[model samples]
Target chain A: MNLPDRHISLAHGNGGRLMRELIELLFAKHLKNPTLDVQADAVTLPLERHGELLFTTDGFTVQPLEFPGGNIGSLSVHGTTNDLAVSGAIPKYLSLNAFIEEGFEVAALERIIISIAQAAKAIDVAVVAGDTKVVRRGEGGGVYLATTGIGIKTTEINLSMSQIQPGDRLLVSGPVGDHGIAVMLAREQFGLRGDLMSDAASVLPFTQALLDLPGLRFMRDPTRGGLATVAHELCRGTGLRVNLDQSAIPLRDPVVSVCDMLGYDPLYLACEGRVVAVIAADQADQALQRWQALPGGELARIIGETESNDPFVVLHTELGGSRILDELEDDPLPRIC
Target chain B: MNLPDRHISLAHGNGGRLMRELIELLFAKHLKNPTLDVQADAVTLPLERHGELLFTTDGFTVQPLEFPGGNIGSLSVHGTTNDLAVSGAIPKYLSLNAFIEEGFEVAALERIIISIAQAAKAIDVAVVAGDTKVVRRGEGGGVYLATTGIGIKTTEINLSMSQIQPGDRLLVSGPVGDHGIAVMLAREQFGLRGDLMSDAASVLPFTQALLDLPGLRFMRDPTRGGLATVAHELCRGTGLRVNLDQSAIPLRDPVVSVCDMLGYDPLYLACEGRVVAVIAADQADQALQRWQALPGGELARIIGETESNDPFVVLHTELGGSRILDELEDDPLPRIC
Candidate 1:
């Protein structure tokens, strides 16, 4: 059976004939698996006897949903998976809940579904359970997606902010602000264009590599408020001072140019796929060398280190002056995912 | 620290200082537990040695956000918990994600959070992880919540539509249409008022009681499209005919009057807290008696029986006539759940 060749109606969320058809034809067709095919209220997951489970949830509401590098569909998967990855867990399954506007196009929905399926497949994760709801046309954006990810921690690694100590070196996986810049240019409100794409991809490989390193203290993805915000949180949580060498932080040319033109700091812009980690100061050099050898970590750098007992982020600029990096106060961007 | 005393701005979702304050002062303050207090990328849950895990997710966008008996906050918990309950699993943890409109009131949000915590506590579940996003004022309803629940099956029961047989009897927990009617009246569009309260609560106790019964084949909460739609799904899945006795169905007087006035079929309206189970015909009476003796199942009824190979629902009306129960074709009521 074919779906209505038009926009989605409230009937599509009625949980009856049309809803079942939409699920079977669209969702199931793209994300087919034994667990999902059961169509039960809940999917039964078979787990090995003893490891701990990782749980994460995120809501994606990126405007102009389809962007240069990825769309909201791919962003949702990457966002949740990255959370699990940074926490030393192997992402396994996800539950997707979609809030669609009543008149959203079926074609657009199908494209997003296909993208989600591909993303999940690439990361070896299963879409085990899902739910959909429709709101009146103006009551919702085109679509908003919330995802819950479940992962398994197989290794005996312990990562926590409390482990961050004085002299611990900080390293970032790649360049900062690519995702924020890409999405901003796609909006076209600034009359700027760029070929830059978001660094949005699974960081499982990079995180896994660091798991074997005994010097690793903690790791986090620099997402919503970017690297500076992450540094601020690490300082706040551990009651330590983070001194960052701003010149050492890597940035793409376009990102640098846009930040200069728009009076934005690259450190405050969001990154869809990047990680910030603390490694024992003595092993910092080895960690950087190893990371640089990896594809996604080619631009990795040792940008900063922790200092004793001061709960603030201090930026050491190239001009021989230092400034305290304060927390964000204004809502500079909306729906940046 | 205190949350900003104003409408939620985009800064609240910026993953910076304001965002942390909002979460710590509001959500975490109310739903706080050891696991959630960790504030890690993901909470690592320790499960017992061996058992199949159950995963379910649902999005709640009920209009007016609050109604007589419960609000969207409590409804969100009940909705996801009930899904797990019907699967014969013990509800454990939930991941909550909320999308709030830019100008939504802080007080209303606090009220909602308090309700959620109470609901979760009553059901012996933990709010282990959560995420929040704020959309532009008009891009969302006041607030929409999506919850993912993880449960464990401790019993050896395996329930599926495939287990439904020709002689299986259908039993409903209690009266229908209370939730849908209550929400409709709360909207005041119909110019009707009543003391009607939604039957939105956890069905854990009810489902837990039936887990020990061997005659129980399958169970589902007749939510979104109601009992009639559920019957249709069972018939379509198993290629069986369901002959339902309309006279045996239970209804509250206010619900019946409202349905009559609006020309709405009570059979097609939603029930937030109810169950429809398929039991062996010979054991149906015992199941009914046991359910009727419970707190919320005072009006439990054996409403129908399954017949082989017909693949449709036949309604034997109180007027002594039979008619085909067609699948839901349109949106009878939106946001009922």
Candidate 2:
């Protein structure tokens, strides 16, 4: 049957054959991770040795449900896990809620559910408690998924605003704006893709690797508002200026070219797999070496440093002047993920 | 400026003066509740003595955010709490996520947030964490909210389908179909109302009250697809037949009348707050009395009893006919939240 009729019908939410099929066919193929196969009521998980727990919840309502790099299911898992990882927590269990449009394809529903299962498995998490509801046509676009995750804090991973001090080094894992640019490429609004690929990967292992090191003080995944916003949040509370060397940051040629074509700033565009980090000056090189050891983070670099000044994020340009990094004014590409 | 102007715009989601105003003026007014007055980043709450934790999450995307007796905010709090309560948990902490269309009214938003806070207060819970994002105008409806709650479980309370037994008497807390009928009236489809109001109260206390009665075998809040679907779930593993007396179940006059006009069954319609219990025959009268003592459960009744001979749900109709209760098939007034 033809899909994207632009509204959700009642049948989309039925939890029988249609719902099961929708979850299996459309969303699961890409998410073939193992933790998702248990099919339990709730995932009872193991925490770190004597770590305090941290839990975070997030909901996805992106239009189109399916995007260039991922769909809502995978995105929900990544988004919730990222929240915990960034907060220095080892994400272990997840709870989910799905709101389906009426008359949605059973195939599509199966795809989403399986995709969620796969994503959970990929990150060593389980889809524990869940609730599903159906909304009639015109009530919703397609499907919306909300995820809540509980994590245990790793003792050595003390990433906090209070940890920042003068002379701290900043770094990012891999390229930025790939996810946003790839989504725009999928839309084909202006045919702006130099064969871009969406950079959507679960960063739990990569985060755990950094936390294993002795000198790191901060870590965050640049997703929704991107690097500019993340940089601002880091600098806002410490009253320490962040002097970033723009030339040192990693970017793919296609991503930069597409941003030029779309009149968008790559700094504010989203990146799903990238991590922004702040490390002590003495340990910066070792941290960079550790990041470069990972497949996705092979191009990790020292992009900035903390300095004595008003809380500001300054980007040094090739033009021999410095430009201040500002908080993102609006989403560069709405529903890019 | 005029708000909820027939269409949600991009400006509504911008977290500027306009967004704050929309929340303060329109939404807060209708959602008028006391806990919302302080308007902090997170609400603080205290649990009852001996109260344990209960948790549940829900995403409400009903086609029309506004219905007869409640809106998404009211549904978010009550619905999540209902799921947690019936599981024998005392819900205490909540995390919420809101996705809004750009140009949604500042007034309407404030009203929704406040209403949510008020609802949580009424139920003696707190909203601990929240996130909000704005989607471009046409990409999203006015708003969608996801809430996750954490509550304590009492010392000795557990409700599950495995607790069911043969010869147990079935009891209902109050009238069925009021919520479903009220929402239908809100849609103004077949001109229905008067004898209906959304059964959208918090059912935590109601569920908790029955637990102290040692004879209470199983309890469930029948929401989507109503009491029939839940009963089917209860009877899944066990070959126990539930014989419900149709004449004994309470239904509002409006609900019965509307059901007749539309050829809908009251058992299939959704109920937000009412509950169903299976108690030993010896404790059925006391259970009914306990339910009747609570305002939310005043119309309590002994609707049926279980028999080992028949494993399905059979309704003993007012006309002395027997009919099996099948799972709800079509969308019974879809989005009648």
The best candidate by DockQ is 1
Show model 2 residue runs off by greater than 4 Å.
Answer: A1-9, A14-50, A155-157, A212-215, B1-55, B136-141, B193-195
Model 1 segments more than 4 A misplaced: A1-4, B1-5
lDDT of 1 by residue, B1-337 (tens): 4334578877788887778888988899999877785368998876665667899999999998999999999999999999999999999999999998988888889999999999999998999999999898899999999999999987488998999999899999999889999999999998999999998988887888888888899999999999998999898889999999999999999999999999999899999999999999989998898899999899999999999856889999889999999999887888897
Q: Per-residue lDDT for A103-125 in model 1, tens only?
A: 99888888888889999999999
Residue-by-residue lDDT tens digits, candidate 2, B16-75: 234344445544544444333313212223334354434456677654666666787888
TM-score leader: 1
Candidate 1, residue A74: lDDT: 92
Scanning candidate 2 chain A in windows of ten residues, the lowest lDDT window is: A37-46
Q: Which docking category, incorrect, acceptable, medium or high, applies to candidate 1?
A: high
Q: What is residue B94's positional error in candidate 1, in angstroms?
A: 0.2
True contacts kept of each: 0.92, 0.19
